[model samples]
Target chain A: MTVSSDTSMIHAVGLRKSFGSKSGETVEAVCGIDVDVRRGESFGFLGPNGAGKSSTMRMIAAVSPISGGSLRILGMDPATQGPQIRARIGVCPQEDTLDTELNVRDNLYIYGRYFGLPRAEVRSRTDELLEFVQLTEKAKAKVEDLSGGMKRRLTIARSLINKPDLLLLDEPTTGLDPQARHVVWDRLFRLKQQGVTLVLTTHYMDEAEQLCDRLVVMDKGVIAAEGSPLELIRAYSTREVVELRFGIGEHEEIAPKVEDLAERVEVLPDRLLLYSSDGEETLAKVHERGLDPIASLVRRSTLEDVFLRLTGRTLVD
Target chain B: MSSTADDGSGALPGTLIRATWVTDYWLTVYKRTWKGTVISSFVTPLLYIVAMGVLLGGFIKGDPAKLEGATSYLSFVAPGMVAAQAMTTVFGEVTYPVMGMIKWHRTYFGMIATPLGIPEVILAHLGFVLFRVATVCAVFLLVMTPFGVFESLGGVVIAFFAQLLIGMAFAVPIYAFTVGLKDESAFALVFRLGMIPMFLFSGAFFPVSNLDAPMEAFAKVTPLWHGVDLTRMLTVGNIDGPMVLVHVVYLSALVVLGWFWAVRRLTRRLTD
Candidate 1:
């Protein structure tokens, strides 16, 4: 019932969502996922496709209902206080729903008015937001005329019209050039610096490593792993990962021979992974055992390694 | 960051009616496109009077008075034009505009995310549709005065009310269909296969009794017939007590059904 709290900006305990007309055939998009996104901290939901990241974000954004269990945003129940929570939160959905009939400036101006902002204030903020998104030159252009990157930026700018305390972004930069992705990252970084709490969903491991203070890797309608990106790597993966490739049939023959050289050995169809404290030392051990790998590479372990180790598959898959 | 008193209860009754949001947004849209819509609403009635009353009526050699129960063919057709205009306004204002807000523009998605509820959105649309129907009827009534179609001030007022009831009655259901539509083809089908036949069969241009039994039965069940009957009763002072009750019930049922369907659709869209 309090407006301000030092607790999580969003909290969910046993949240669940399922869809389908039939009983047993229902697809549980989110299955009893518990989360606590603290105020002023950037939280990330890291997962691959069909992992229920967007569904959870939708629940927190108050657009999708909590099928069961407790959920709160800005210290209010979404079912009862949806409007108030939504008023205090800004959401940039996975898909851009910009009004194509209106030009860029009107898109911002009209959405601002929906929050009851004054016409003069909407005008001023329109100018400010266009400048923020670097779309001032294209202010009068219809939304249909803008590129994908430009539209995504405008959506982010539009979400900030009310200067929301909690911001929800679903796949903020899914399909964009590197330059456009960096622009979005920079804006999000600026928002973080200004003490805005952000909860974002993305399958991109690098995006999570770059922006998140703490993250949860979701899989199969639940949180498969949760920690800081670095913490998760330390817990599930070693300091360095060595990839050894060989001819298709040789990988299986070499798998057992190199099993004891590293802390963990994973055999793949065309390659093998050796998780070791020292990648160079592990490679030397592989050579000492007379295993002539077709190719070998040593690299620092990443969140992708942890994700792959935890879920038994690649993150981007 | 600005902290104010926490009214966390958020229990202000009627505070969330929030029709003003739609009205505010629509007023902006309407202001930008008012003249075009106004001209469009009047064109149909004007054309109907010219083509049906003037040109078609001219070709008929029989006594127009004996056939129409009016001294002038223009007077008889003028009331029908009001009925036609009201029906057209309902279909136009209620159908695509509301659908576009929900599906295409996704404006309602942004709206329901605010303090506004689904019912408030529906009511605001109904309010806008009724307001438009009333305005168009007023304009049509003004155009009819010179032709001596206004029997009395009461008749003019009755005609306006009839237009509003008829508009809302059709609007509620069409608004439902608009929300449920998955594609644009269904909208074209409504206009082509549905609305055209309703207009022709519902006594908007002529009396329903002039048609055969099956067509008459279809007209009696439709909201357009009740609306046309109400408009005719007002314009000509030909009120039969039982007939008035039938029109009122038919329109009321349609309004209720439309409202029910619309709310259910909103639940499915917003909650799911």
Candidate 2:
């Protein structure tokens, strides 16, 4: 079949994926979600572990089969044109799928060859990707010698050897330190600026805010909310949050006292969160009501706060 | 970006091109580590010929009628030793290496993420297995020349191809078993249950006809005996055309069937 003439890099309608568990039952990992990732836009799937983020990414990478519904990657049906779609897309999987047998440079070279690129072209692109990922110096080293962050960069570099139209990163910086994470984010930002349509999965709200132009916050195999970070915050959360830490075991009791002081009151085990348009005003009213908190802080609402509003749970454990 | 079109029909030539790239990767790996396998590939074959044919044959005085239709025990054992060496080397190639690709190193998973299909991956691996068998058996033939193992060079040449065919027969099925493994210990079970039994009773050192009827019949069922007897037949300059045909067809059938089974298991594991 001819490639579909679509403007979007990825278009999915009611995408679904399921696995047969050991108990002889089918467990749905991604239950019918529509997704449209347009050309040159950075989109993300923001979710905690077990949210089906990796499963969806695998299907889009054309490495996993779809159990139900439809998925078109880069305007070609993955079921029929998996190799064709994968040829045009770069994928940095959640797991480190790098070849341990080959040294750093050969990983990129072999991956490019898998897409049927010429040897000289793969060699030149290998050098270019090593430079891009700041791994030129380590090109001759074994993959085992590289640290976790360095391995992640090499995987990213290997994915791009084909110069794909679309780039998919699953948990790109999940296990990296803050400084190393920023380095990855910076490189990704550069790729986005170069007009590579990027799709990534991350549970880190800051990462979503830093890299994604738009995203879907997924939970329990479904999309809970979808928007830009600011738009999600503005729609689901107040302008600010006042975090109040009270004396031992007083949070639940004091939560009722501040019920009328904000748009919403959430009582955690250690603290009470007052969601309000004006955090200082909410704190002042809490004091006027004789509710003495041990400590307090006013902060601008973030995607975490938005996630809390939509899912009634925190983003990370 | 370059055009992302499927190669016409995505069969034969397209599969071959991609499979060759995969073979190239293995070739690169082999270039690095082949030096380390010199013991098994070259030196080990030499030791086996000396120990089994020359050293051990010095003792046996089989019935003058025939030592499995050979005048000397060395002549009978030489061909079997070569065939058995091919089996051992191919077993090494397809077992842990296959498991490592599927599970530990995740190299196959990485390839699947790219445009390489599972069929290409399988074909490329078995191609490398073929190469491994060729190199080991070639070294074996060179080692055997001084021992006067072959009646003629042309006959030895025919025996060499027979060795290759038998090597594939062993490799394809063993690879099928390796792909379905999760734990490394399962390999030990295969060694104890399948490899060792077949290696010992495949008439490499003695005739299987000496065994009881049940055991002899069982030896005939294993592919290695066909390899050993056929290689021996050609090596001794004896023409049993019908029996040779039977051996070729049987080993070839195993290679084809085991290949499909391997492809199916790999596709299921990697794709799902």
- Number of the top-ranking candidate, with lDDT as the measure: 2
A136-218 per-residue lDDT for model 2 (tens digits): 99999999899898999999998898888899999999889988998899999999999899999998989999999999999
Q: Provide the lDDT at A192 for model 1.
A: 98
| True-vs-predicted CA distance for residue B176, candidate 1, Å | 1.0
* Candidate 2 Cα lDDT to native: 0.87
Model 1 segments more than 4 A misplaced: A22-24, A245-257, A267-271, A287-295, B2-17, B31-39, B61-69
Q: Write the per-residue lDDT of candidate 1 for residues A1-317, one digit (tens) a residue.
A: 36456677888899998887546687889999889889899999988898999888878888788787799788788888766776678889887878887789988987776666667877898899899889999999999999889999999998888788888889999999899999999999999999999899998888999999999999999998899999999999999999999987888877888888899987777789999999999999889888888899999999988988988987776
Winning candidate number (TM-score): 2
What is the overall TM-score of model 1 with all chains considered together?
0.91
lDDT of 1 by residue, B1-272 (tens): 52212232345443344555556667767787788986666775566667877788666655654434555656666777787778787888867787788777787777766556677777877887888888888887876776676567897787788788888888888888787776667878888887888878777667777789997897888777788778877787667879888888888888898888998987787667
* Index of the highest-DockQ prediction: 2
Off by over 4 Å in 2: A1-3, A247-250, B4-9, B64-66
Tell me each candidate's TM-score: 0.91, 0.96
In angstroms, the error of model 1 at A241 is 1.1
Weakest 10 consecutive residues of candidate 1 chain B by summed lDDT = B1-10
